[model samples]
Target chain A: MVNMLSIKNLHAGIEEKNILKGLDLTINPGEVHAIMGPNGAGKSTLGYVLSGRDGYEVTEGEATLNGQDLLDMEIEERAVAGLFLAFQYPVEIPGVSNMVFMKESVNAARIARGQEEYTAGEFLKLAKEACKQVQLPLDFLKRGVNEGFSGGEKKRNEIMQMILLQPSICFLDETDSGLDVDALKTVADGVNSQRSPERSFVVVTHYQRLLDYIKPDFVHILADGKIIKSGDASLALKIENEGYGFLGLNYVEEKA
Target chain B: MSQWLEDVIAHAEQPASNELAATWLAEQRNSSLKKLKEQKWPTRRTEAWANTSLVSVESRNAKPTPANITSWDKPAIPGLDSIDIYFVGGQLKTDLSTFTLPEGLSIYTLQDEKAEAVAASRFAQIKPERHIFGLINDAIANSGVVIDVAENAIIDTPIRLIHLANDGVENHSRVLVNVAKHAKVTIIEHGVGEEDSVNTSMSEFDVADNATLYHYRFALFTQKALHVGGCHFQVGASSYINSTIVAFGSDLSKLNIDVNYTGEHSNVDINAMYLLAEGEAFDLQSTIEHAVPNGTSNEKVHGIIGDRARANFGGRIHIHRDAQKTLAQLNNRNLLLSRRALINTKPELEIYADDVRCAHGATIAEIDDESLYYLLTRGIPRSQALIMLNFGFIQELINDIEIDPIRAWLTDMLSTRFKSMEVS
Candidate 1:
């Protein structure tokens, strides 16, 4: 099977600190990869690097999507290439409406792939349907992007965008942190419905609860900017029960 | 040489320009012209022109020359239909004038003696120590748009004042708009021209009791022109006024938007935008006077500077000693798109009333990188995203532009003016 994403010897960091050092991971299509890590173990940095955040410098190794060189592309080009990342801390844009932002984004990706941009009516139809799937209210589309949303609402909004965008490979960085049970279920369902043999998902989480709901095919444990263990979904249980300290790693700083 | 100034003032014979003024108004214009000759041209030493240059005004000739209108061409201003008026060099282009005055409203150029005298007396309480251009507008304003919005008449359409400059010679012009009690109307002053020749202009606005006005101005000009204009608003009891000024060019431009809430419960909202690029210079000096009790005023201005361009904003909010519950706020923010660009913003609040709420702030900085990258991650091209971010910064206030035609016109001008800026 062709791998949907491949990261090898990835050494990335912001400023002087190397947050993601010598990290190697491979994600195949149809697989849900759950990355569980200690607080500063490069989990979020990895997500940012994959999405091409400006400040994070990628020093070593290479990351590729399908067979294309992903690390070398610009941020927007990478997004057009089917990379979608749900940020851990979403920024609030004061004046651009969510609907306008969504439509522009959808058409931008479509145009990059030689597809015609969606008409206003078509864009609204798709946006409305996605909002329903994520259980977001209709009025959410009228307000500025993430301007006045609550924490859970913001998370649901991100998932709603993911549904509308429908990228080939999606990255959810701590998307479940602020969600309530109902919101979490809606988000999980939104993700599950998009699962297909040709699509892949990378879910970076802080708790084992999201894993129970997400049902990942593989689980990876990361510490000290590197992934130390990888196994089937059961690996999440060992880490959840043993608390990561048993791996000869001082995860006390992470737990604190 | 046929005297250009004589030809400019002899615009009365043009039927198109004199369509609105009454017979008596034409007679009053002669007296006003006599008055204009008595005053000397204003200079930078004056209090109002403190931060501006007076080179254009000092160099302009004041003389008697036989007129010839044959060589002049009709000028064009984008979104011309929005207003009805013949433009000046800042002189009136008599051949291209039109007037479709709404009911209970009348417009007359001071060139008409009878109409000029009637305007002078009827609105005598609203004048502010007439300047040289004001005198010119009064004496020789052979073409001026006079608006007398009837009491309680709600005008749904915006009356546009289109000023087009047609000659390579100096010209001066003026605008006077009066709204009666309980009347509602919006007068848009769209100033767009490229005159290698210089020009000076003024607009005096009056709003009576319980009236409302949305006065918007768009000045996109060339370095050869210098816009030293003034806008005086005399607000009556319980009236509301919103003023928006968008300035893009001028070798030197100074707009003093003065608002006086003369009666109780009057309110004023002033918002302006200035985009200075290349070697152009732009400045907006605003003064808000809360003269009566419970008067409120708010001012917001944004400047976008690039290359060697410069922008200056001096916003002053004053609250009278007896005025209580006066809420005033002034904020000015600028983005320096180039390191060579310079901008100076002064936010001043003078509150003699102890119970007033007056606050002002100014900030200048570059666009945030995180914001740039965030948009990029959403698949917006870097350049496109930068434009979006800039647009987004001003979207909240810009969304208030009610007329579709004007809104579209503003968008078109903004997009076309900035080469690297994209609208789609």
Candidate 2:
């Protein structure tokens, strides 16, 4: 079967410096892949390069989503083609309400896919359900997009958006950071609930605490811009206990 | 001064047999005419008119269109039951005798016998003498109306003042509104014209003690029309006044909004929004005076300038010595959609009272790249995302409008404007 996401010899960086050097990974449909990395390991750069974010230069790489070239499309076009990136720091749009923003986003994606757009009532119903799934209040839908939202709330809002958009491939960039025990579980549950045979997840995290809630089918240790080791879920527990000291690698403590 | 000013003076000096010229306004007009003569026309060197030019108003040679010759399309506010008064070509086109007003409410032309007494105290008094066009308006404005709301009366139906002018016409319009003690009323001043025309539209509102006033001023002229107007309010003690202003730029358009706190414990909220595109220009000057103790005022001015359009805003808050407990805040924020677009913003606070709380801030910014990318990442097209982000900056104030119909109408109009500005 064709992989859900295939990245081969991916060498990318922001601006002049190269970060990802010959990084290779493949995610099959319905599989959960956890990428464990230290600071400056180029884990997040992979997501940015695939999403076609401006300034993220793909120096040498071949990244595809379901056999389609992801690097050649616009950021919005990639999003419409079932690519979702849950930002580590979501931006705040002060005047655009969350509901209106999501409506436009979802409708745009639907139209690009040749599907009928959701009516106002239909969109609201879907949004409310997604809001509830992530433990966000319904009123958050009425507030400005992530305006004045707490760190945990913003993370949950991203999950809420992912739930509503229903993209095929999701890249969770350090989503487990800055979240409390309760919020981490809420986010993990939100992600786990969406797991299906047709959807894939690439969860990038520094700590293994989140892996306890959402089990990963495979775990890879990314160090020095490349994945040096790959194992099953047990490898995450070993890192939690050993802290990368056995591999002669330095482990940067998670940020508070 | 250009020949336009000279011609206006000559026209004001010419004798007329109109019934309005025979009223007490005649004396006030003569005094204003004297001031207009003494006052030098504003130039780029003038402080108040620094960023705005009077070239269009000074060069236009549009003859006043004959009254009753032009057809006026009255604007409607969806779901708003309002008593409409139409003014076309500087003349009252609405037949007031056809509709009965609400209880304790009165509306009449300035030529009516009751206006002589009203004009004596309010003709040109509320508006400051600093504006040369105001003086010109006082001298040449012959078509006007006076509105009165009795004490303790609550007028549910809004009074809409609609002004329209044909192309190549010079129209001067005026309105005076008096809300007595303990009364409440809603007044909307709506003007629309986009021709090679000149309009000096002015209105003065006197809100008495313990009263409430909801006011809206929509300056919807664009292209070749030259509009110079002012809305002045004297807020009484223990009263509440909420005023909202929405304006689009024209060949030359300027608006002055002055709120004077005449009584203690009064509150005034002034929210102004302007959108200018192409070669349009809009100048907005708002001043709030706290002359008494325990008064509060808030002013929020937001604008979007696109293409080569230019916008200027001057917000001044003055607290007097006796206003020990005054609280005032003014914030002006602008967004320039193009590198060629320009915005000149100045926020000033003059406080003599040491114990008062006052703050002012102004900011001119471009569309945030992070915010734009955030929206784009959500699968919204670049153009749609651009509009969403642009309109987001103005939606805060539009959401503050208490009138639903007005808010909806403004949102639709501004969205259309944003789409045009972005697509081009």
DockQ winner: 2
Clashing pairs in 2: none
Docking outcome class, model 1: medium
RMSD of 2: 4.1
Task: Specify the highest-TM-score model's number.
Answer: 2
Residues B1-424, model 2: lDDT tens digits: 8778887787788776233464678888888999999999889999999999887777655353235535756778788889988777788877877979879898878777776665678878988888888898888776788898999999998899987777777678889999999999999999888977788889999999999999999999899888999999999999999999999998799999988888899999988999998999999998888889999998889899999999989988888999999989999999888999999999999999999888889988887888888888889998789878877658789999998988998988887888788423
Candidate 1 per-residue lDDT over residues A1-256, each given as its tens digit: 5578999999999887788889999999888999998888889999899988877899899999988999999999999999999888777886678888888888899999999999999999998988888888899998888889998888888888888888989999999998888888888988989898878999999888888888999999989888899998888888888887778876556433
| Tens digit of per-residue lDDT, candidate 1, span B1-424 | 1233344345534454445446555445555556654554455576655656666544455321212334444433355454456555544555333555567666655454535533665432354545544444544443455566778888876766665554455445666778889999888776655666544556777889999998887776667766656677889999999887888867877676778787899888887887776877887877788878998888889777878788878888888898899988889988787778878778888888889877889988777777677778889877777777775445445666766666666666665555452222
Model 1 chain A worst lDDT run, 10 consecutive residues = A247-256
DockQ, all models? 0.50, 0.67
Candidate 2 residue A5 Cα shift, in angstroms, is 2.9
Residue B13 displacement (Å), model 2: 1.4
The iRMS of the candidates, in order, is: 1.1, 0.9
Off by over 4 Å in 2: A1-3, A7-13, A16-26, A34-41, A57-63, A67-69, A92-157, A177-190, A206-256, B17-20, B62-69, B380-393
